[model samples]
Target: MIGVGKMKQYTNVLDKPLTKGKQEVSLSAFAFLFSELVQYNQTQVDNIGELERRLEDAGYAVGARVLELLCHRDKGNRRETRLLGILSFVHSTVWKVLFGKVADSLEKGTEHEDEYMISEKELLVNRFISIPKDMGTFNCGAFVAGIVRGVLDGAGFPAVVTAHFVPVEGQQRPRTTILIKFAEEVLHREARLG
Candidate 1:
């Protein structure tokens, strides 16, 4: 017997095979949904920083789920155990699965041992919605930063993650950079593991 509200069995989503970043929702549809997410969060906060935080928190939930799914389905229950390995997994596998492409670049910070940066020429959130001048420093990419944080934290590598726009030499729209600063315990663990 089938329930009225529930979906009829059709291979069950969990039983279906995962796609190789090829399956996608329409870009316009995704943009519209993301825009709605930002707007809903906007109504909940008093300032730009708070808004970003809320967006990040929302993203963290997604990131956590992504980590779990990838761990079980894609990697065959194997999780990366090294710092660089995890970062590379995020930059390549995770990004590909989420956005249909790998991140543009991943780099270690020049001035700090605890920092790394993942940069994209045009981040998905930043691609469609343009920020007005009044909303200074309000980056929708904060959600993606949250996603990164969630993925890292779920993988036992907690860190502070943030998104910023950096100017290019000749480009009009600045690139978005997700900066990750590892927690003290993560660094200590890395050293001990080494």
Candidate 2:
């Protein structure tokens, strides 16, 4: 066998310096890639709901990895434990990183103690999607919902995360709301912590 020199390894991911500024994913570029993801998933599912679910499942993995990387790299392995802290992280930190800005609103659910709502006037995924009437109201926010679930669940705050389109009184298009319902244990823990 011919003699081969050992390949030198570059700096580890943890050793790299954090980004100095926001990395912009242009709307056009993001739209193209997101459309491709939806199209690729379209072939695999029989119906719109399945397609959305698959997308959500795919996003769940991405969210889980994102949490791990951010915790280790950005936060120096510190993770948010409180409900509000994690929600703020998702609303501000995660949203800023992914969508280039903080979400429009983060509101406590009026009817429920365990629920919260994260609303965006124009969600990144919904901006790129154009579903037909026959297909029904298929909100692409499901994928984002999965991402939130993954982040919360990975951080030890298990919850049921979902997305819905709520109408805006004056706007022609509806806004997306990511609804998170915390598990019983999570609520209990929050009570204890309080």
Question: Ten-residue segment with the worst summed lDDT in candidate 2?
Answer: 1-10
lDDT of each: 0.90, 0.86
Question: What are the per-model numbers of colliding residue pairs?
Answer: 0, 0
Worst 10 residues of 1 by lDDT: 1-10
Note each model's CA RMSD in angstroms.
4.5, 6.4
* Cα-lDDT of candidate 2: 0.86
Tens-digit lDDT string for candidate 2 (133-154):
8878788888899899889989
Model 1 residue 93 distance off true place after TM-score fit, in angstroms: 0.4
Best candidate according to lDDT: 1
Candidate 2 regions with alpha-carbon error over 4 angstroms: 1-16, 20-22
Cα deviation at 175, candidate 1, in Å, is: 0.3
Clashing pairs in 1: none
